[model samples]
Target: MISSKEIKRKPDQDASKHYDSVIDKVLQKLDTVCKEVIDRTNQNNQQENEEARFGQQVKQKPMNEERKEKEENALLLQLAEKDKGRLHLFIKLVDYMTVETLVSINQTSMSMLLEEMKKERKNGLFNTAVNFDVQIFTPDEKEISEHLKCLLDDMIVVMRNTARVISHQSMIGYIKNTKLGELLSEQKENKDCIADVQGIITDSIEYQNIKNEIFEKVTSDFQAAEVYVNTNYMRCKPIYEFLNTWNQGDFENKEHTLDIIKSHVMELKKWLADINFYIKDIAKGILNVDGKKIKNKLQPQVVTKLENFKDYLYKLMQKKANQTLTTLQTYTSNLSKNPQNLKEYAEFIEAIQEAEQNIKGLETAKIEVEAMHSLLKSKFDLNPLKNSDIVMMDDIQAEYLRLTLKIKEAEELCKERKQEMMKKHEAEFIKFITNIQNTTSSVNKGKLILEETQPADALQQLNEIKTRSLDRFKELDKNYQHYAKLMGLSVTTNKDLQELEATYNDRRMLWTHSDKFNKLYEDLQKNIFTTLNVEEIEKEMKSYEIGILKLRQNINNLSKEGRDKVLDQHANRVGNVSQFMPVIQALGNKDLRPRHWKKIFEDLGSAWQPGKTFTLQELIADGVMNKKDKIEEISAKASGEASIEAQIEDIKSKWSQLSFIVNHYREAKDKFIIGSLDDIIAALDDHQLKVQTKLGTRFVAEIRPSC
Candidate 1:
């Protein structure tokens, strides 16, 4: 049987089970999202052929109707021609501003030309209806205006329709062919036919095809190129490839590159997303092919920047390919340090705060425990009981009762003895009692004599006296000891109560810091009080919490870390901020840019026609970057020096002045001994460094085939 002893028993609450359930739920949700993503990918993959087929269908348009209905469509053609003519005039006037500004000026000038024509007509010096609106414009004017209009429209559609098999029908292509044919006999303002007319015609199919082919894979190449520009062309080749490749495989193993692409997108989006991001003149030049000199200077810089950017993007692609052995967890161990994982680290702070708060509450709880101990100790006297007189009270009471009963029985015998003794004494004392006894003795003797006469009365009187005496004595002895025990127990209760009070007072001090207790409580409420299992909560925190907090704090503070840390953050933050990485990359990329890639693809198709092994270097020298890797024979003996060394030497020669100033400043300084010499040395050193560092690297590895 269980003893009826009350004790403080500890309770077992299985918190871990609850926590596990929560974690399982969270992972299940994530799995669901993953499944959905996979399902969507499968769906897209299944429909790719349909998309391609649709593209082919979109290529078929009513070309014959457009050709035959020229007079009815004369306004559009006339406007197209006028636009080309205006483009030439505007190109000369390109040093100025917007199409609005240029067009206003052009319109004013055209008005005067019309006015002159009107005067000539009045003088009978002109022929036919001189309608500027109806008349066809010059080739350059039509080229410029229509190009502008096309840019404003869907450029992809225009490029496709112009170069596609079904719609291989650009006016420029037709006009260029006719122009080439009549070049010897007659020529019209032929300054703009560019790179080479004969070479352009020779590679016309290739050029057209290349122009048709996407130079920029809008998502990958552009995104990568965006990063390339931001990081500079440090890893230019990889950026170029990334920007130039099929982006349908864009996200395959592209975690790092995705971030970079995102960052690139953000920066490039800053330039492109905003209609007002660039200057108006630049925008106007970009919008319309005005061939303006002012724009010409800027174009090469932008293009070069774009090219260098492409290189950087290529490197990023390389980086994406070069996966490290360490897992993501290794990189995300202390997310606070990794700016990339900042988003995930925010919650970790909350968890830590909760833990710390829980610990604080535990301190209070510990104090409460001590209070409970004091309460128990006070209320229950578990302390040893001192030896008491009560221990023998029962035995003594029993013995006393037995003796009383025996004595009562012995009363008769004692009375008989007394009577016998008294009989002898009575005779002798009779005379003395008679002589000495007063009324009481005489009465007692008389009563004894009466009792002798009536023994029952005397016996009754004796029994009553004995019973009352016994009861009185028993009450005194037993009640006192029992009362003492009760008193002792009361004392113990009071003592324990005092102790508990003291303990409570001490515990109360633990609650003195209300802020801490409340905060801890709040943290508990925030972190774990709800569901329970949060093991990976810590893991997730380790992955993303800490970093997020640090970043948020830093952002809030409007402060920055050390330069090295900032640099690291900058690299990491490249993609963390933006989702528009592709646009920037495409805009900045040289290889993938429609202008460059289109030419290359077209030339490749033309040159590498079915049965030919063309001289690749010759094309390369002519600024044609063909899209294939090739190896050519070379003799080590004939080339006594290494290709890399020779190329390096050439690079050194080109950047000789820059290197000289930066490299030999210290040597130059020591050679000077005077005060002015020190200043001269400092100035020269500064100048040299400024020149060299600012000049940047201009080395081309392709030249050496090794550098």
Candidate 2:
């Protein structure tokens, strides 16, 4: 181990010592130069201060004094020119020393020392150049001062360039040490390692500051180096942002995520391509590599990874787009099958809207993917996905159009159907109105008939009208309700139908009371002779009277003018019954024999016989008297010779009829020829006529001749 290795190690140690000694000497000379510059600047400042203190007391100087001042400034410029070369050499040495020192130091220490050097240089030399006092110095002095400042600025630029080179080399060394290039080369497998490298490059404050310094020092001297550092830094910054901002879950099969991935990939490709172009010249100068080689190392691999990731995203997008298309197709197909009703139509419309939204999303997705494709082709020269891979909005729009056409056709059909239904309903309504009007007319006609007809006949006619009207009204009301509901109209109330129903109800009530009274009167007539229950008959008559009163009240309650007509008819019927009620009571007596009844009926001029049906009209038509009046006349005759006189008159009337028949037979016998058939028929005809003439003399003479 001590043989050849020790000999080689000794030379490297000596070289290191020599380099360190050289850097120290350069730094010492730079310090001396800086001190001389600081003293000269202080002297100039003092001279300026003294001139300003006396400038108000002596505003204008003489031409000779000004020439003298100029000569003095020229001499000072000549002296500064003599020291300018040394100052330039010292600044060069200082710049070289600064680069070597930065190169020799660790990255952390170099970064800290560089920051301090930048601050000191800016505060001292840069400020001195920027704030140069032209008023205090002569023209030659100002020219000399400008030349010195330019030399110092050049030295500072070289120092800054050296610092940038060292920083770039350090960054490149760090990249190499971390195997960042290898990680980038195998980004798919070493994704986490690349991510970590990106994190270091982006998140490290020291690295960021160095990168900023390189960018700030963008001059012709190190423009390539700045671009190189910036390119590497930019390359990692986006990757860092992307990697840190997103995760595997963010790449879901959704439009928003797909769009985000597409945008990021496109931006990365564009940024990476721009960075490659920016550093093309410097690639060989500073980094000692070809621009294309660097690009091929970084861009192609990164592009490949992006292409793969984009491919994954595209596949997801395709899958999602296909699903959306399938959903849209299904909705369109279902919508094409026409909806039957409002509810189904509404559901179809909602589905169509959702389909439209999905179509919009698909279109957006397609645009995003196509944009990514365009970026990749123009910038990265990648063609992983074809245009056919994208979902077409035309197909979706066509489906939507078909859906709309179907909807339009369905709407037209519904409109036609509605119009047809409305026509049919209108016809039906007209028929209903006509039927109601006819029913009302029939009721009016019945009302007219009620005026002239008997109570019983009026009741019958009213009942018929009520039945017909009720049937018609029920049908009309049912139809009205059904049609109204179908048309979405309120069917709860109809003034015409309600009024008609009320009229029918009122007439029914009037007839009902009339029917009750008629029934009571019939009972009185049926029970009058069937039983000797006079008190029951009187009770029935009282009930009949009460029924007539109620009927009259009901008639008065009627809104129609027929009330008085019905009332008058009912009153006439009741008056006819009352006029013959006493006769009915007298005929109901069970103590009377059939002969007495026959005699009484004969005297009353009635055709009614015993065991036959009796009625009040029959007795009224026969001019019958009251039972009380007949009894009073009989009692007064019984107390006098009225009964004997009535029997003598009866004997006289029979003796007279016997004498006349004997006289007529004797006359017929005297005129007759025995056994002659013609004479016998003639004689019979003569006797019949003579007897009829004698019987007709007791009856009232007819005012009108018989037909």
Off by over 4 Å in 2: 1-249, 252-262, 278-297, 338-397, 417-707
Which pairs in model 2 have colliding backbones?
none
Name the 10 consecutive residues with the lowest summed lDDT in model 2: 122-131
Per-residue lDDT for 1-707 in model 2, tens only?
12223333333344445545665565555556656764665565576577779877876889799779968865775565456435534454445455544433424443563454344221222111110122311222234334333432332232232222112222232233334434434653544222222232345476456645533432221344334545553444454344445555455544465446657676766756664654342221212222343344555555666766656755654565565456657866765655454344445545555655565665565455456556555545655555555335445445555655655564555545565555566676778777776665555455533555555676677677667776667876786676556555566665666656765665555556566668767766555454446666567667656766765665455535635566566667777767666655555554344545566666676664669656555555566654446733333333333333344456456545542112334557566333435644564576557545533542212211320
Best of the candidates, lDDT: 2
- My TM-score estimates for the predictions, one after another, are 0.11, 0.25
Candidate 1, residues 257-369: lDDT per residue as tens digits?
33454455344334322222221221111121111332244334445444444444444423322221111222223222311221222233333334334434433433333
Model 1's C-alpha root-mean-square deviation from the true structure amounts to 55.1
Model 1 residue 49 distance off true place after TM-score fit, in angstroms: 99
